[model samples]
Target: MQALRIGTWNLASGRDGSGRSADAATLRAAVAGVDVDVLAVQEVDVGQPRSHGADQPAEVAAGLGARDWRFAAAVAGTPDPFRSWTPIEPPVLRGPDQAPSGPHYGIALLSRLPVRRWSVLPLGAGRAKLPLQAPDPRTGRNRWWWFPDEPRLAIAAELGHCTVVATHLSFAPHTALRQLVRLRRWCARLPGPVVLAGDLNLVGPVPARVFGAARLVSAPSYPATAPRVQLDHVLGPAGLDPQRPGAHRLALGDHRLVTVTVHPR
Candidate 1:
């Protein structure tokens, strides 16, 4: 049986601690350390000013020694006016600094094998409004919060004999459910043997049912310090089993890299 090893990680702006930025060496080391055939990365800042206006996907792909790579920008064009965040310091680079432009953050897929086709699916028309849920520290009561706008996206690619889809869902349950419904419809049109992976932003049976995916027998992949939920996942067709499902302990980002080796029908 042939198996495909998949990995996903949120690079956290490709930055390390001490306010220093992640370089080619650092990115290369991270990917090399992971044992996966394909990688789905989120929160990747491409052509951002703080990242030295570097194309992060290209840089990481080069570092990983991957010949083919594709990126889908969530925020295409200028930065969202509502988001007023700025770079605290400039990044270290071999060349002169360039102004940041285009998508502020987006998703990317890097593969050692050739990708026959790829497409980016918008999660929703615009930012979705969702009820907030936060645990109170003192009162020990759950509080409600509302996020005005959130970016959501999914990318689908056709591999040799299967289709691979990656997405990052919203924190709100309603929003996630809606996105999941759309994802299911999209997956239905794909060929047999489909794999969906990413941060669903929700826990429990909702995700499993909406996507019609079988959860991997793996540990959780959120809050790397001490994971409490399985926010990151890789689901495959029925009867398909993940050879070895597990999570990484590295502090690469808030979310740990969830990987699975699966044998498709």
Candidate 2:
């Protein structure tokens, strides 16, 4: 059986100096550090003002020696408020305003394999009504909320005999559930084996149910530092078995890189 290796990470590239623009050395290390046939990335900035209008997806892809790269701009373009920190609501939340041309902060899939087919699945309509709160490590203030306008998206690509879907879901449980429903429907329509990976933003039985019945493998992936929630995941059809399952911690983003190897059953 042919083995397929995949890796995913939510590289938080934005206006904030959160190590979004990974240096060449860091990118090289990240690529060499993980073992995967393809890499799926979230929060990649494209022509974002904060990123100095750099094409981060292309930059990282080139750094990893991956010439074939696919990208979907969840947020096309918007107004930049010069200096503003207020978190806007979804749909209107205005993703990384800096990036007004393409996905304010979109997802990207980079691979050395030839892409046979591709499509994007928008997660929610208008703006997702989800809430996320994180304690400011620097300020000790809790209840910080930021809603991303670009609804989570699923990008599916056909690689030889397998199909790969990469997405980043909402933190809201209901929104995630709705996204999964759409995901399952899409997966059912694809030909050949299918594999899905992303930051689902939920934990426990919910995820298990969505991908579990589909016979996709599930492994904990989240909080790159010290994972308390299994927000990230990798799932494949029942016919495939996980050869190895694990995640990598990096200082560049809040999420870790989940890598998995699968063998046909």
Candidate 3:
């Protein structure tokens, strides 16, 4: 049996918690700090101008020595302020070898361990516009805006020992709960010892109740600099042991990287 250190982070597209662009080295170190063998990153950029048109996943993957990784694009364009962005009709899934064209935004799975297969689940975008507390691009200060929901999706990688799933759920009132139900159905059909990790956007004790599993890893991850809520997570089977890093060494983004070690079947 193989044990793995798994981690999840909503990177906010390579931007630091202070809203500063992280250089390649800083980006690499941020991921490395978590010290995870397999990582699931959400809100990542692919060929986006804001992130300097860089493939954020590939950059950090190379830095972390992750030989295998996949970026699942949920939308075709950036969800910029005052600009409208639409979901990718079919969505785009890109591997390391593929040169992903156009600016796309989504979640990604990167692993040092080899994966036997890859799959995706579509958690459609919410219709309601919601108010969000975000940073001002010009001033790097917190601001509120009625942001429209973007497309949501999940990616799962089947390793020899276990299948790992990653995603970022919509924050709309009851939409996230509905999405979790669908995701639970999908996980039930997969192989045994399936591990789920990502930002569900559901806080308090809701995830454990909705996901139908004990939270594998836990911490206040949101608002990275001074987190007060646990929006990110890692969930696994009953017998598995969960662990967390002592603390985040860097402000990777608005959410801190949550990690745990697990024995795979």
Against the reference, the lDDT scores of all candidates come to 0.69, 0.65, 0.82
Cα shift from native, residue 108, model 3 (Å): 0.4
**C-alpha-based local distance difference test score of model 3:** 0.82
Better of 2 and 3 by TM-score: 3
Task: Name the weakest run of 10 consecutive residues (lDDT summed) in model 3.
Answer: 242-251
Question: Candidate 1 regions off by >4 Å?
Answer: 17-20, 77-103, 125-148
The all-Cα superposition gives candidate 2 an RMSD in Å to the true structure of 6.0
Residue range 67-114, candidate 1, lDDT tens digits: 566666665544433352332122111111343345456677777777
Tens digit of per-residue lDDT, candidate 3, span 53-73: 888889879878898999998
- Candidate 3 regions exceeding 4 Å error are 83-85, 133-144, 244-249
- Best to worst by TM-score, what's the order? 3, 1, 2
Give the count of colliding residue pairs in each prediction: 2, 5, 0
Shift of residue 246 alpha carbon in model 1, Å: 0.3
